[model samples]
Target chain A: SLSTSAASESDADELQKEQQARSVLRENFLRCLLSAASKNVQFNMYEKVKMEAKFGACDIDVLNFQVSDLHTPIGVQKEALIRSQDVISFTFEI
Target chain B: MEGGWPLLGPLQWVRYVKKQVKVKVGRNEEVRGWLFTVDPVSASMVLVDFMESEGTLVQVVMGHAVEEVQVLKEPDRKIADRLQSMFLPPRTSILDP
Candidate 1:
């Protein structure tokens, strides 16, 4: 009984540590996203598709990004929503 | 590896913080930078690269597209401090009248 209780207690501590780490990482990431707002960002998508747009905001699920003046291969779109799955990475200056 | 990066939990993801890593996204896409932070919810990684003439450059590699991530090297104290300050505001100075 003692060993079982000790093991469960250690498990709880590990879970707490993991949660703290997640919160810190998520906070810093949110801060980075906030700084990216209003800045110009270049998105590199699949199939060699690259475009630049004014960084706006991403949805809560991080599934789509709302951008303005999206530069595409054909022409510049006034507004667009970029699916996160289509994008591999995005670059911007801080 | 169980859907690659997205499967890595917070404890494992935190190990890459402050270290230099090379991330492979899709075909022919490889990026190297300091591991600033990884979003646990989205599993995206925020990378920072510093340049002399130019300012710091930030890159966010999506979690779904990450093919592989390899730790290249570890950052020194100075480099870690620089990485942490990139998005933070400048500290206020105390006034002595």
Candidate 2:
């Protein structure tokens, strides 16, 4: 059906947007983390960022960004899985 | 609503542009339609448009009769609060100025 095709296309678009937004959020998070680390802020973090895009009633998909870090990269990569909330929701629809 | 002036300290209130704040500048006789653009500047505000009597353009500082800011919408506060929390490091020092 045409509506189905359109829905598929929209879904694809949403995924693309989500990834892009997530990348940006990750970039910013990394920048801050690096900046703070460079300044020696006493936090030794090594974790991953999770970005989820959820559509609202107004067709706006809010990017929910969650960031977590550990003292060692190996901790997140292979040891354990945990996430913290310096998270923020960014609305990307207009 | 917050974080823009040196008074507000070093904080990123605006990710792109400074906030638009509605304000009534001047005393009883010297007031009219005025829209204020607030940023971290020595000047109180940059007047965008004023639909009132013609007078020499002047700065609007709190001491110079600028009224207390009134946040019109909750979104304004939400955005401001978000910006505030985003930049707050876990251990900000008292030596920071």
**Which lDDT value does model 1 have at A4?**
96
Which segments of candidate 2 are over 4 A away from where they belong?
A43-94, B1-97
How close is chain B to the truth by TM-score, in each candidate? 0.86, 0.30
Alpha-carbon shift of residue A26 in model 2 (angstroms): 0.5
Model 2 lDDT tens row, A9-62 = 999997776555445433333332233221211111123333322221110121
Of the true interface contacts, what fraction does each candidate have?
Answer: 0.88, 0.00
lDDT of 2 at A7: 100
Model 1 complex DockQ against the native: 0.87
TM-score of each: 0.93, 0.26
Which residue pairs in candidate 2 have backbone atoms (N, alpha carbon, C) closer than 3 angstroms, thus clashing?
A: A46-A70
Best of the candidates, lDDT? 1
lDDT of 2 by residue, B1-97 (tens): 3232324311221222224344443332222212222223221332222225752232222212344433333335644443333334556533345
lDDT of 1 by residue, A1-94 (tens): 9999999999999999999999989988988988899999999999899999999999867899999999998999999999999999999997
TM-score of chain A of 2: 0.42
DockQ (C-alpha based) per candidate is 0.87, 0.01
- Quality of model 1 by C-alpha lDDT: 0.89
Q: lDDT tens string, model 1, B5-90? A: 98988999989999999998888679999999998988999999987888789999999888889999999989987876667645
